[model samples]
Each structure stands twice: as C-alpha cells, then as structure tokens.
Target: MASKQIQCEICFKEYAVGYCKTCGHIGDACVDIHNTGKVFQTHSVIMHEAVNVHEDDRENPKVIIRDASEERCKQHATERAIFLCTRHDTMICGRCLHSEHLSCGKEVVDLLREVGSIDCEKVNTMKSLLMEVKNEILLLKDDAENSKENFKTNADNCAQECIELGIKIKQRVDELTNVLIDEITKKHNENESTYSRITRTYNEKITWCENEERKIDQFVHNNMAGYLYLLSRKFDKGVSDVRSNLREIKHKHTFKRFEFKENRVILKCVFEDLEDVCEHQDEVTGSDDGSVNDVFEPTTEIQKTRRELTALSHKAKEYLDKSIKERLTVEAELKRTKADLNRVEKEIIDN
Candidate 1:
C-alpha cells in the first residue's frame, strides 16, 4: 500500500508526515498565501498584496505580514510569524524574529542589509493607509465640532425665545397693572375733598366744645354757692352758654369713614392659575372694590414657547447622541490605525 502524504499549504510541498519537512510549519497552515493574496513580493508583477490585514483590522489595518508568502500569526497578532525560507525573505516583529529564529545565537540574517532592499510599493501602501486614517480622524473632529456648535446655537435660541416670552408677559402684566392702579388713583382722589371737608367740620365743633368746657370748669370752681342753688340765674346762664356753643355744631353734616373693600385673594388666585385667568375674571372681579378696577396673565404664549424650546432641546439631544456615537466609532478606528502605524514604523527602523 502507498503511504499517505499531506501537502504544506505555504510552499505547496507534499510531505509524508503531518508537519512540513522542509520549512517549519507544524500541523496547521499559518497563512493561505494563494487564498488571502495579501503579501508583498520581490517580483514586480506582485504575487500578493503587501500586507496581510485581517477583516477585523480592515478599518485600521496593521501589517501582519510584510513579504509575499511570508506568514504571520493572525490569531495572536501581538505575536505574528513569517514563512520559513533559506533566503530569509520573511518580515516579522523583533520579538518573533528573536524567539523563533535567532534565539540560539545564530547570526543568520542582517536586518540592516534587508532594509535597503525594502520594496517601494510597500512604503507607498503604508503611506496610503495612513492618509486614509488621517482623513478619518479629521472627519471625526469636524463632526464633533459641528455638533457642539449646533447644540449651542439651538440652546441659545431656545433660551432667547423663553426670555422674549417672559419680557412680553411682563409688559402685558405691567400694562394691566397700570390700568388698575390708575383706576384706584381716580377713585381714591374722588374721596379726597369729602375727607378734607369732614375733617375741617370736626375740628370746628371740637374747638367750640373745648372753649365751653374750660368756661364751665372755671365758673363751677369760682361759684360753689351757685352750684348748690338749683333755681339760680347762674344755672340759667350756664344753660344759655351751652345752647350757644351747640348752635354752631347743629345743622352740620355727619361724617362716614372713607374705606375700600377687597374681594378676597382673588388677584393671587388669578395669577397662580394664570392659564385660567380670563376664565376666572368674572369670579375675580368685584364692584371694583366699590372704588373702581383690573390684570393680565400671559399663559398661552408662554406654554407655546416652552413647547418649542422642548422640541429644540430634543432635536439637539439627538444630534449630540448621533455625534457621540460616530465619534466613538471613529476614535476606535483611529486608535487601531495609530497602533498599526507605530508597528510599521518600528519594523522599518529595525529592518
């Protein structure tokens, strides 16, 4: 019977055992050079692409392998690999090169010599990738900035609208208040003359009484005998004097105190329930305090403006949320790109 043979995926060399007998791939293929077709080759036509970028790293690709047919560890990107060749054409990280090939103090390949022979196409590809990454970062910045400015503008506009509404409401209130205050002044002024006339009449009557009382007290003290003589002429004279003093007070108008009546806390209740101010006007209003009346409340306009502001706020929030999500995604890509760039730069330096 013929012995079973297995082919090495890298060089397509058939071997009788599991591992590649010539190169050093053990059980599994590190890279499918033909299938992936993403390696840089020495030939001008190109055996594959310059780098082996995984699907996960496509947005911000890292060079997992450098040369065509050069295999790298895709599973453990931090510990990538290379194709085993006597020509030492594979490109690998410093750690992998040391641990995998040169750990035994074998002075096999000179990295300094290899650097001069690096393909110009590889450098160009790296530059193109980096340029794309740069554009992505800039786009992210612009999005964030625009989001901030738009949000700020919306916020300011909403605030200004509210302020204008407040000013308008204040003006209306002031107008209503002025009308009420003017009415109060007119009503109160009407009673001014009556108040003055009544006060003056009262002063005159009190003056007459004061004078008569003093005279009475003097007479009583001076004529104690006359006070006991009930039918004396002195008593008749005293009665006549009292009649003379009261005669001036008689026929004068009686006075009633001037007052203004308030109808509960109607104004307070009206103002508190501003939305219902007009509806409750009948309940709030009285006989103008029997002194003449009024108030205005801006409820509908305020509510309308508030609703507009709320809508603006919601729109701004959505924009901000979208911008944040976009920024986060871009930033992640940027980070990976930068790491890839660093890896490429280090490889260049080491080579």
Candidate 2:
C-alpha cells in the first residue's frame, strides 16, 4: 500500500506524518523555507537584525517587534505598498526604500512631500477655532466658579440677616412684655388701694350709724324718726362716693388693655418706630456683546439670563467630559506615534 503525504500551508515542503518533521509544525511541510519568495527573504533579514536589538535585556519583546514593524512600515509605505500593508497607512520615505524594501516592487508616494506643497489655510482656520473654543471653556469655568462663590456669599448674608433680625425681634418682644407687666402691676396696685380705702370708709360710716342708733334707743319714743332720716342720708352719700371710685377703677382697668394691640404679635408691636429692611441684587451678562443688566426678579430678561446660565453650565460640564475624552484619545495617539518613532530610530541603529 502507498502512503499519502500532506503539504504545509506556508512552506509547501511535503512530509509523511501529522506534523512537519523538519519545522515541528502541525503540517507535513518545511515551513521555514517555503513560498515566501525574495521579498520575504529581505524582510526576514531585516527582522533578524531588528530582533537582536538590545540583546542585553530579555524583557520588552515589543521593543524589538515594534522596531521591526516600523522599519517595515517605512520601507514598504509607497502609495501602492501602503495600500497593501495594513500596518503603516502612509507613504514610505526615501530612506526606507533602500534600507528595508530592497526587493519589493510596490510603487510608493511621498505623503510628507505632497503635504509640504499643499495650501493649509483651512487647517489653520480649524486650529484657530479649536483654540477659541478652548479659551471659551476656560473663561466659562472661571465665571461659574465666581458665580458660585457669589451665591454662597449672598446666602451667607441672608443667613446673617435672619439671625440678626431674629435677635432684634426677641429683644423687642422681651422689652414690650416687661413694660406690659409693669403697667398691669401699677394699675392693679392703684385699684387695690382705692378698694381698700372705700371699704374702710364704709366700716367707719356703719360704726357711726350704730353709735347714733344706740343713743336714739335711749330716747326711743322722742328722736327715732329724725335719727333714721339723718342716718339714711349719710349712708346714701357714702354709697355714691364708693360707686364713683369703682367706676374710676374700671376706667383704669380699660387703660391697662391699651398696652396690647388687636391681632398683632408682641414682637411686632410698634412702640419705638422699628422697621425691617431687606435688599437684593441681580446682575446678568450677555455672552455675545458682554452686555450687563441689573434688575430685580420677575423680569423677563432676568429670568431668561438665569435659564441661559443654567443651560450654559450644563453644556459646559458636558463639553468638559467630551474634551477630556478627546484629549485622552489624542494623547494616546501621540504616545503611539512617539513609540513608533522610537522603534524606527532603534531599527535604524540596528540596521
């Protein structure tokens, strides 16, 4: 029976097993020296020299790989070759052509040479616009911070006013309460003294009437009607005087009520002509013309400015996030380009 042989994918050398006996690959072929042609030989020679870069250090295989890739990218980077190679998407330099792409037949273009001749007015305009946008962002951030600080200051002032006003109100309330108590005490004392004097006079008059009655009892038959008439008249006069004093005391009681006003808090009482004075200020600026307007709330322009500031603040935050992301992307690209440059330098030194 005859044995069937399998071929390797890269090197078409045939073998009679599951793997290539020469290269130890999972195919029956010599993969090292197969269908690479002359171009592959030149690339391999360049890669071998690049792989031995900084042989003193075993780490950083990327450094050697990058060196090889960059060298190859620069070498084969012509207009046609750049299209063929998926790594470097630019045209190859003159130095790269002779150094690495010695056997390659691919056509090349000089992108750098072309760019040097092209007009860049539009690019410059875009760069200027980008600068202006960046400056606007910075100014917006500064203004936002300033506005926040001003708001904090206003809030602090309001809080301070509330505290001071509260203290003044409590003080006024206490002072008025003390005065009311004093008036009530004075009026009560006067009423009490008047009632005590009237009661004593009543007792004295009754005693006098009793004494006269005793004397009249001794002469009962002769003087009874005359003494009774005199006693009645004197007692009626005393009762009238007592009623007049009681009315005076009632008037005084009404006077005590004058200290308190109807439907008003004691703290709000207007004894010494006190008033509350509060002030507020608003300032608005336009972004285009930098026009400023200072007005009270409820005005249409003021409301619009507030809304615009709020919207602008939100937009600023969103723009900041996007700018940060873009900056990071640009920085990453710059770092990759720098690394590519370093690799090319290292490869040039190696070659």
Candidate 3:
C-alpha cells in the first residue's frame, strides 16, 4: 500500500497529501502534468470536488485556484483547455487531441504558445488610433458648439438690424405723410382766402350799380325841361361810366376764374408728381444736402458686413457637414478598435 501511494505529476515523487504543491494538482492520485492520456481522469474527480466545495462556500466568495484558471472542457469536464484548433478555430482540452483533433492534420497548436506570439505593438497602435479619433471627435464637438453659438448670435444681430430698418421706414413714411398733409392744407387756405376776396369785391360793385340806377330814376321823374335836359347829359355820362366799370369788372372776374382753374390744375399736378417722388425716393435728388440719400441707402459698412456674414454662414454650414461625417467615421473606427481591443484582452486573459 505504501508503494502504491499517489505520486506527484511533475516531480514523479510519491505524495500522501491531497494537494501537490509541486505540480499544482489537487487529488489523491496525480497524472503526468504534461501528458494528456491520464490527466483527464485524475483532474476530473479533483476539480468536481473543488467546484462543489466552491459552490458551498459561496457565502465567503473566496478566490480559488480553479477559479483563476481556464474553464474546463465540455467533453472532459475537469481538464482545462490547453490547445487551440486553428482549423476549426475552437479551444479543446488534452483529451480532445486524440478524440476530436486526431484527423485535424496538425492544425492544433498550444493555446499558450499562440497567445504568447501575439504582437502587443499592434494593440498599442490600435489604442493610439482610438485616442487620436477620440481627440478629433472632441475637437469637432467643440467646434460644433461654437458654431451653434455664433449662428445664434449672427441671427440675433440680423433680426435686430431688420427691426431697426423697419422702424426707420415707418418713420420715413410718417414724415412723408405729414409733409403731404401740410401742402394740401396750405393750398386749401389760399384758395379759401381768394374766394373771400373775390366775393367782397363783387358785392361792392353791385351796390354801386344799384345806387346809380336810383339817381337816374329820380332825374327822369322831374317836370322842368331845362333841368331835365341838363340831367339827361349827366345821366348819359353816368350811364357810360357805369358801362365801362361793368365791362372792366367782368373782364377781371373772367381772368380770376381762369386763374382759379389753373390753380386747381396745378394742385392736381403737384399730387401726381408727389406720387412719383415718393415711389422713387432713392433715385430722386432733393435738397442737395445728402440727407435724403442717407435715408434711402444703407451704410457701406453695414452692407459689407452683411455680405461677409452671409459667406461665413455658408462656410460654417459646409464645415459642419464635413465635421459630422468625419465624426461619424471616427466613431465607427473607434467602435471597431474597441472590439478588437476587447478581443485582445480576452485572448490574453484566456491564455
């Protein structure tokens, strides 16, 4: 029985302890550490007991040697996978070498060997690329934010300018309306004064004519022949004087009526001319002083700034579109790089 005691898998020395520190196997009997033949049988029983014990100690949650190692193979539940089948791209335990990978034609390689051969520089390069893309995206984000603020500021400024222009136009219209009203009122007052003067002169002429007719009537009623004869000559002269005055008054009245009609035509022409003047205020040259021009035309500086802002806005839109596309591309590359990095990390841990 003593000679038949369990032996250590690594040193091949007989061991009575359940665990062998030299070979790192927990069992009453140990198989060759590097041999795949009997390793499954020996490790299966030991790992099964260990898993049960670990489950029972869930409250403590202590880390076990089995927990730190690779997972056991599905076919050989206690044997950890140690080989990677390149042909099938799968992991297998030692027992799978003869059973599943016997006809694989040398495609199987040690998992540790493959993992060790990985180039860390490639991973570092990928990390650098991811960082660079991240930085570029950050810059794009900042630019977008700045552009948004600038757009808002420009829009607000334009809105304010439009409001000011509207106010100025309203003021100009009000001033024009007042000026037109003043001109119309002045013409109306002149016409009224002329009418009053003409009416008073016509009334005085009529009263003088009536008094002369009464004097003629009284002279004709007298019975004395010599007195009547003398009165007749005076009356004839008075009649001739009255006729001349009447003719003069009639000619003056006719001239005054023509003048009043001309005044009305002139007032109509003024209104029609004013319509054209207001319509083309910008083209009209009034009051050689440049005040009218200033009211019609925007300042050179303001127009120049408006053009510049329009061009800048267009450029900003183009840049924003380019930035968005670049950001999307960078994000896609970042996601792919992250996936590759995770795969590398997982491979390292598994190895």
Candidate 4:
C-alpha cells in the first residue's frame, strides 16, 4: 500500500492546500503551479502577494502575467517609452492614466502589448501634432530674434539723435549768450557817451554864468564911482538928455553878447563904428574838447534789446524742451520694444 500523505515541514499536520505552511509558497505537486507556465510560476510569493494574480479560465488553461508590457521598459531601445494617445494628439508614459481617450482605457502594460496593432489614424494624428508644435515654436523663435535686432537698431538711432540734438542746443545757447552780452555792452557805451556829453554842456553853461556875474559886478562898481556921479550931476538936465547919455555909453561897451550853439559857444562884441576908439579889439573864437565817458548805464535801447534777447532765449529753451520730449518718446518706445522682445524670448524658451 502507498504511504498516507504527511506534512514534511509542519509537524503533526497534513498538507491540506498543497502549499508549504512554513513559507506560504505553493507546493510543487499542485496543478495550479504546474499548469500556470514558467512566466507566472517562477515569481516569488512576494510578487504574487502584491498583485491579484489568477489563472485564465478559458477552455485551455493559459498562463497570465501581470504588469508586463513594452511600455513599462525601453522596448524601442530609446530613452523615452512613448505611448501615443491619438485622441488627445499627445504622447504619454506607462505611468500616465489620462481619461480623455477610449484607447487609454487599458492599463499601461496591456496598451503597450498591443502597440504593434494600434490604429494607424491615431499615429498619423500624433505625428502631425508634433510637427505643428515644432513649426510654431520655430516661427516664434525667429520672430523673437528679429524683434531684438529691430529694437537694437532703433535704440542706436535714438542715441545718435539725442547726441545731435544736445549738441545743437548747447551751440545755440552759447551763440545767444554772446549776442546778448555784445548788445548790452553796446547799449552801455552809448548811454555813457550821452551822459558825458550832457554833463559837459551843463558845466560849460555854469562857467559862462560865473563869468557873466563877474562882469556884472565890475560894471556895477564903475557905475557907482564915476558913471553914477555923472548921472547925479546931470539930474538937473531933462529925462530925455539922461536916456541919450546912457545910449551913447552902451555903444562903446567891451563885453556885450554870449551865444550858445549845439555843444559849442560863440562870443560877439561891438564898439560902435569906430575902428581905433577902444584899446582892445573885438573878436570871436572857441575851442572844442571832449573826454572819455567815466561810467556807462543801459538806455531804453538796451532794455528793449535785453527783452528781445530774453524772448529769443525762451524760444530756444522751448525748442530744447520739444527735442527732449521727442527723445523721451523715443526712449519710451525703446523700452516698450525691449519689454516685448524679452516677453517673446521668454515665450520661446517656455515653448
């Protein structure tokens, strides 16, 4: 008789489930272990315990392997394990579980197992989408490069314009300043000359008045001592005789007339019609002299000229302000262009 079944590893217990009780691994004699095939049977208990592994219940016992597919490994011998998602026109990995597409309904392993017989239309669509993204990115890169070059060109032009305008403004300021100084100087010189001429004329008039006063004093002295006595002695005569005597005395006067002309003087004296009646002869003579102006002050012409210069200076400043505003506008445009170029560049990099 054959020996009754006995537990080899477990003492005092028979093997009931056809698996070892010590390690929990299936027994070597079981149909489940023998019929499952080498691929599923060689896995350790650890792997079986982690997954819900089971036998296929078809007419024929087919061994089933879990989580085994090309998508999980480098099947194409490339770095990327690309799985085409045709519905979304994207590529994903075995770890991706996108729910957008019916084709992604299967697990990553089953999906890669059938990658060879995938729909041709989905593959074509994925390739078309990749090509479109590449083309768009290339166009955007080119546009960004062109924009940067254009901004550089515009900035250079603006810098040159600013330099040119600044030089022009400085030159204009210098020219205007010189003109104003020269005009003011000329006005000062003219005013000084006028003041000096007027002062000289007044002084000459004062000197003439002093000389006339001396002459009147001498005439009065002569009249009181001799002519007055003669007149008092002749008071017994008629008034008409006294008037005739006074007229005859005036006909022989020494200093008689002083005349003034423009910035000059003239003297005239008469001794009646007698040529040898007086000791001194009558004559007229004058001398012309002048001096440099001591001080200068602005006249009305100077004030008007200064005002006009101020107006011109204000106009120049206004033009400078306009030029500066134009420069600022150009700078603002350049800044905007730089920002646009940077943003476009960033977009390209991100893409």
* Candidate maximizing lDDT: 3
On TM-score, who's better, 1 or 4?
Answer: 4
Q: lDDT rank, highest first?
A: 3, 2, 1, 4
State in Å the error of residue 119, model 2: 8.5
Candidate 3 displacement at residue 316 in angstroms: 44
**Model 3 per-residue lDDT tens digits across residues 192-235:** 77667667766776787687666557767764567567766777
Residues 60-87, candidate 4: write the lDDT tens digits. Answer: 2222233323222223222234565555
* Every candidate's lDDT: 0.54, 0.55, 0.61, 0.51
RMSD of each: 34.5, 32.2, 31.4, 37.4
The segments of candidate 3 whose C-alpha lies over 4 angstroms from its true place after superposition are 1-120, 209-351
Give the residue spans of candidate 1 off by over 4 A: 1-69, 72-147, 185-192, 207-351
**Reference-based TM-score of each model:** 0.29, 0.36, 0.36, 0.30
Model 1, residue 105: distance off in Å is: 42
Tell me how far the alpha carbon of residue 9 in candidate 2 is from the true structure, in angstroms, after superposition: 16
TM-score of 1: 0.29
For model 2, residues 1-351, the per-residue Cα lDDT tens digits are: 111233433455543233222222222233333335444343222111123334543442222222121222433332122222124334454555566544554444444433344368978999999999999999988988987898789789889988898798889789978988898888878767767766776576677668766765755667668776666678667667756756765554332223545556543545322432334456554445665444447433233344587799999999999999999999999999999999999999999
| Model 4 pairs in collision | none
**In model 2, what is the error at residue 250, expressed in angstroms?**
12
- Given candidate 2, what's the lDDT at residue 11? 51
Least accurate stretch of 10 residues (summed lDDT) in model 1?
Answer: 40-49
Listed per model in order, the count of residue pairs whose N, CA or C atoms clash below 3 Å is 2, 3, 0, 0
